[model samples]
Target chain A: MNDKKTTHFGFQEVPVEEKAERVAEVFHSVAAKYDVMNDLMSGGIHRLWKRFTIEASGVRAGHKVLDIAGGTGDLSYQFAKLVGSNGQVVLADINASMLGVGRDRLTDRGIAGNINFAQCDAQFLPFPDNTFDCITIAFGLRNVTDKDMALRSMLRVLKPGGRLLVLEFSKPQSEILSKIYDTYSFKVLPFMGKLVTNDAESYRYLAESIRMHPDQQTLKEMMDTAGFVRTEFHNMTGGIVALHKGIKP
Target chain B: MALFMTSTLTIAALASAEKMLNAALRYDPATRIGLAQLEGKILAVQITAPALQFFIMPMDDELRLMGNWDGDVDTRITGSLLALAQLSQTEIHNLKDSGVTVMGDLSLLADLQRLVKNLDIDWEEMLSQFTGDIVGHQTAQMIRAKFGWAKDRAQSAQRLTSEFLTEELKALPSKPELEDFYRQVDDLRLAVDRAAARVETIINRKNIKEKSNP
Candidate 1:
């Protein structure tokens, strides 16, 4: 028998092998409708959140950068412009549906040759070890089945001094803010989902997934355990999302 | 022969990709094959959108949908927002019987209304086709457009935790006077950490200092 036990999909547990495909299906179902849903759900603050992440990234001209799980390539487009002709940015995603959307969006935006697309998984990246300068996975890590293994894979691929930036939804800090957030996400967010995508289950999955994801501190520790030295996190928007940055020593 | 084999493999790969897109969108049989074919090249979205709500909201908490009064979001808000809006009083009451109460103070609703208006969103046009529990059609379209760029970008951001200081991450500053940015990443990381630590300390939160290189 296959030694690997099954894991949960939502509340009910399922076989591990099926997770990636299921996740892919989830993205596919919402791929064309993904961006719109994001706005209604987040109330449009997600843009600034990303701008903050980009600024914090400190990627400069001629610096090669990679945006993994770059759904529609928003960051990649910006990075390409920042990197200029001498630099390169790869808009990579494991979901072909997302990657297709990203590639088209980037091309439409008049992004030049510096940007490219790669359909690859997070845990098993398809590139030479130590090939990239900076690697970032925003909001995407939580969707992966084995996050620890994913972090370790990232460490292996990073050069000795390469930095990793992990940006994702995290636990809020203040009680008042938490309460307001609770009312919004649980009450308003899925309602927005139902009103918009016409698929409530997917948005519910998204919320549960965020809640299930490791918090900023836990992710920082995970970074350290995965071999990143000097782990730190910036709790943006009062810990709603955190940018965990660390380096390979 | 090897080159031929490699090129052939690439061709096969492309063909399979074509096959996958065909399979993925097949569920919506009414969707035009042309639309399905175009879904193949998956381009970056070219949305001429206004400011995002996450920015407008006081915090990310605004994104929470379902949950209790305790502040942690309940999960039902994910796919059920618009459907709830469409629900009649009796339907809402029936839903309440099932333990889901979506109603809230009018101020929050007003906030959402103002935000939609400020963005000049075409709600009526957008929401007409929106079916199911995800949201109104217009709401879903906007959500996908707005967050698609960000969520996708944020999820896939990987950094060179070890070699950020190396050439792979380093931009060539050939002429004198340009800064060597990667060398400064470590210092920047420290600066950020110290700032975060200071905030925690100032607030009397737990000792969440930088993890020293053990």
Candidate 2:
């Protein structure tokens, strides 16, 4: 009788249309303390993960890069420097609060003249077709309501021979590591979130969302299904986080 | 697991090295300016013994070291770690036989060598930022004087050890004695070649006479 489509927002099932708003509320709540929480939760290993993504991106001078869901402008800051004066970097995020925080942070750091900010959803990118040479969504894709749709949207915006890098949590390779990671995610992360950001529920949702997201092979297959070629993945931190890369043909 | 460990470790190592080098370079403004001039150029260092390679890209007065780079590099040097270290400290032209193979832009390597040679860090000024000016100045002076004394002592000890080995212990050849031995060996090699040539001529003559008589 109530068949209006449903999707997983963390462990609970919700209407497809409400997932985006709910996810936005979570980001809005954590936008101010996002960077601090990231550093604390991952013990600064996220920086190395982003560095690896930057190396794999192959972005040089005079290239257009889009940092989708680029909260806090971490990747955008590096991309702006790498692209030089002639290039452009657009930091796009769905939540206005995260975008505002990222914009203010980057502007305060004097990272202007080659960077722009866009408040747009990943599922329906507002850019023209075949625009960006490289696109990256770090730790943000799992929060997307429709990942397949977002991947196709990214593919559409990428130029022929452009690349898309997805840095997110994935299944661990070893059993023991998986057990430890599970315990940390479900227990330690929420506790830290409560201590730091005073929002345990958002961190709990984060853990659940990462678990609900596709595994490495499944995500690579998803990219293949979304009309991307040369789809491959590199697992970092014993596969607790995987950087999946796909190139547009 | 191996890939994960290797990549994480390599990235961590590169990040730390880059940070330390940049921190040092910050104290040496001349080197930083020189580095800025070499922006957009990439240098690839291939260490053969460990079978490792990394890329160094200079940008914005700092060096960016990466574990993996897929773009075209301006210069590449391949050798063992020791050979590469020697190449960095010595003149690039003088190290032609140092077992380090350099490819691509030779001028870039030369410029980099020049920058390294001219690096003069103001240790006093750098320390002043942390410890007050007087303490920093005294500490720097002490370090400089100690370094100078250590250099003199190291050279004297090296000479004394060489003398003990060659003259006192008779365990190794001295420089002049080694040169004389080399000269004698060369002369003996030439004499042996002349004798062989004369023997060959005599054998040829005997062969010719035997052929005519037969």
Interface RMSD for each predicted structure: 21.4, 2.7
Evaluated on the second chain alone, the candidates' TM-scores are 0.18, 0.53
Q: Tens digit of lDDT per residue, candidate 2, span B70-135?
A: 679899989975566445545666656788888999888888777765455565664343345786
Docking class of 1: incorrect
Model 1's DockQ? 0.01
Candidate 1 lDDT over B1-214, as tens digits, reads 1111112122232233333433443453433332322221111111122200110111111211100011111121212333332321112224443322433333433333333222323333333322323444665565556556655565555334323434455554332324556557778999999999998787663333333332
Best by TM-score: 2
Highest DockQ among the candidates is held by which one?
2
- Model 2, residue A2: displacement in angstroms? 2.0
Alpha-carbon interface RMSD of model 2?
A: 2.7
For candidate 2, write residues A1-249 as lDDT tens digits: 887899999999999999999999999999999999999999999999999999888899999999999999999999999999999999999999999999999999989999999999999999999999999999989989889999999999999999999999999999999999999999999999999999999999999999999999999999999999988899998999999989999
Fnat of candidate 2, please? 0.58
Cα lDDT for residue B53, candidate 1: 11
In order, the first chain's TM-score in every candidate is 0.94, 0.99
TM per prediction: 0.53, 0.79
